[model samples]
Target: MDDQDILMVSEAQIAESFDADGLMLKPLTLFIKTEHPDVIERELSVLGFFSISTSTTPEKTPMYEFTLSPLNT
Candidate 1:
């Protein structure tokens, strides 16, 4: 994937997408749950999250990144 194709989305958005489409229609780049750690543990495990911390702002409010697993069945 190229830099232009990258999209960062939260877990809620991921769920919404999955629910609306019944599956992931497009490839997801980084899956994030924001400052919510509990959601990360339960929601992102199936995607095989890499669980990396990122600083989205200058104050660096800790953001979480989940590396998605292959969706192909």
Candidate 2:
């Protein structure tokens, strides 16, 4: 099949979330949980907030990009 005939589906880009001073998401989550378990619980209670607040479309299943390799004669 020609290159144009190949079909590919890819995942949406995930953004890096940070605190006001630029603390990374993981670190921030850990820090918050350590000091305030309630905060983490509250955050989790509001499901889908991360993607929703960031305007990201949730991925139900993993998607991949399809590549076409040329057949050798």
Candidate 3:
């Protein structure tokens, strides 16, 4: 995603969403908005890097939430 499509979520909000386990790294959640949600979804799905979920604002604006975590190899 480009800089324009990304919305920065606050550190406090991220901390609140996740539990702390000092030994482990935290997952990152990205909030992305785009005119073509389907295209973005398809692209991300092809990459197979993130766990994606979708939602829409009250005004029917599409938002994509992508969560990335360390993979256990």
Top TM-score: which candidate number? 3
Q: TM-score for every candidate vs. truth?
A: 0.33, 0.21, 0.46
- Give the C-alpha lDDT of model 2: 0.28
Q: List all candidate RMSDs to the true structure.
A: 10.5, 20.3, 5.6
Candidate 2 TM-score, true structure as reference: 0.21
Q: 13 in model 3: Cα distance from truth in Å?
A: 8.4
| lDDT at position 14, candidate 1 | 66
Better of 1 and 2 by TM-score: 1
Candidate 1 residue 12 Cα shift, in angstroms, is 19
Q: Which candidate gets the maximum lDDT versus the true structure?
A: 3
lDDT of 2 by residue, 1-73 (tens): 1222222333221123344563334311211112333444455446533321111124432222212211221
- Sorting all predicted structures by TM-score, with the top scorer first, yields 3, 1, 2
Deviation from native of the Cα of residue 54 in model 3, angstroms: 1.2
Q: Candidate 1 on 1-46: residue-level lDDT in tens?
A: 2212223677775674354646654444463435555555565564
**lDDT ranking of the models:** 3, 1, 2
- What stretches of model 2 exceed 4 Å from their correct place? 1-33, 48-73
